[model samples]
Target: MSRNIPLLDLQKEFEMLKPELMPALEEVLSSARFIMGPQLDELNDHIQSLLGVKHHIPCANGTDALLIALKALDIQPGDEVITTPFTFVATAETIAFAGAVPVFTDIRSDTCLMDPNLIEERITEKTKAIIPVHLFGQMVPMEPVMTIAKKYGLKVIEDTAQAIGATQHGCFAGTIGDIGTISYFPSKNLGAYGDAGGIVTNNDSLAETCALIANHGQAHKYEHHLIGLNSRMDSLQAAILNVKIKYLEEWNILRAEKAAWYHKYLDPSVETPVTVPGNTHIYHQYTIKVDQRDALKEYLAGQGIATAVHYPIPLNEQPAIAALKLHGFPTPVAAKTAQRVLSLPMNQYLSEEDIRYVADAVNSFLNTKKSQSFQNSPTGSSV
Candidate 1:
């Protein structure tokens, strides 16, 4: 069977927003201001207003956003920043890029967020910050994390790349931390047409520093202050994002509705995603846990269903970063969870029929596996 359900359908999303997208692009082209244009300023203003943050600095991409946030905080060589191992490499890569060591912490078994209970044990005299990723569109348990940070005077940077509109107990995901970073990658909840990102902070000085860092540390047109990277969002991407921002809340609601549909139809034998209490999950990816994950993924694919592993290998185990020589962190929970987690098709554009079909396919695969296991038992012949 040909593959039917996909992980995401950006084409359908574009079709829904074409009416506004075309005019926005045309406006940018006519103005001829592609860099640092009016659209960029408008997007920054809109993001600040939406998140109720004091400053919103747009950057080239999500990775750059994290790097800029770290630079703004003055995290440097010999400093250690604690973060979860079960996340996209960018979460830890940016820390190392900022000339700091990324100390790994295990995630909670249920929520898949960094375990706050294990954090204090990892802090040392060189610890400067803690980066808690809002994984799979749910906010990390910030209350406990924040308390721990306060006790040790460590700064917090919320990696909100996946959880743009998520909230916890009335606090927005990114806004709760000292510095918050968002990604506008094509797949994110609030994605632009291409690579783009933003940095958010309530602190006036940090905000100024972030803007300077993203703009090559330029105090003026020709004068350079601090060494920085060239990371800026172009006018076209900013214009596209401006149009999409108006529909972000509604799309998130649709994603939630689809998640509910998945919950209603999927077999109870498999594990479904658990929303952290007091959190509004945007369902960037409707991930589930199941035994025999690799075999089940192949089974689903053969039945025309698409599945993905968000992170098959934890950051600490990736060979590419072996030069960091990180070791001795107890991350049993992260290591175990990485082997079993599977992401099903999830997006605002999915239909009820699409959700039902995917769930039915998964159920069929699991049922077959169970039958095979029972038949292979030693006592099967007697029965």
Candidate 2:
């Protein structure tokens, strides 16, 4: 029997949470206080408690959270912020939008994380901060990154968009850095009903500045103190996220279990995700690296299985940033990785049977490719 598996299915998640979510939505609709309602405060409190942070500033989306954090840190024109080129463009886009140059850095081949070894060489007098992204629900080696930041007096902003409940050595992803950002874009580990995000910080001054900036730079209503954007979290989205946060840890566990199933069953010739020591990976996307990535993706589609590429191009090669005329740094690993990475179907709702099926399909395709290659060899002969 042919099975249809999607990369991610939000409908199943919604049906499971409908019992608890409907009332929350009804309560918000009844109150008629759509924007900046009580739900936002409730959600903020829950997130702050979850991450053990002092303050949580809710915003409209993840991109805004990054921008707000950079602006609050006073990143001025010509300043440089270091980050990896392998991640989503928003990581570098926010830096450029904040009037700072995003210094691209290479990544490690094993973990696909920003190489802490390569960061210091890019530092200059104008380098003001480091934005280490926890790509695909895994933590960057923060101990050394933090050490470097301390030596250079550079601020650290963690882009924890894909990793919410992940931890390294018992320290949470967003809590380790000076400022951290999370996304609730309906596809995140702790997704909301719509676009939503939050900023986390232990620094009282930075927290206050970010909150003010998110609320139109106001010290009081209609009193603008500094230039800022109007980026507030919607009350309805907050209500949805408040409910979803309760299950985030459990969902992450299930995701990890699913990833393990893949690790056990996948072909040994393919490369699987690597988890750093003492770190808890939430498995936002169970991505695998294989040769003939595009052909394999097409083969999977024919078998009624869905797949996706997390990123098909490195940030430095993107046309959108071409106008910035940024200097190019050698990111050979990231450049090579973009061509071979493929994300498999992953969700808490998936069963063991489903995982096995996906693995079987992938192996069947890989085996076929191997057989074809051997037959095409010059020394090959029919058995």
lDDT of 2 by residue, 211-261 (tens): 999999999889998898989999999999989889999999999999999
Per-model C-alpha RMSD: 1.2, 1.0
Clash pairs detected, candidate 2 = none
Q: TM-score for each prediction?
A: 0.98, 0.98
The sequence of per-residue lDDT tens digits that candidate 1 reaches over residues 4-100 is: 8889889998998999999999999999999999998899889988888888999999999999999889899879999999999999999988789
Local lDDT at 376 for model 2: 86
Give lDDT per model, in order: 0.91, 0.92
Candidate 2's C-alpha runs over 4 A off are: 381-383
What candidate 1 gets wrong by more than 4 Å, as runs, is 1-3
Of candidate 1, the 10-residue stretch with the lowest lDDT total is: 319-328
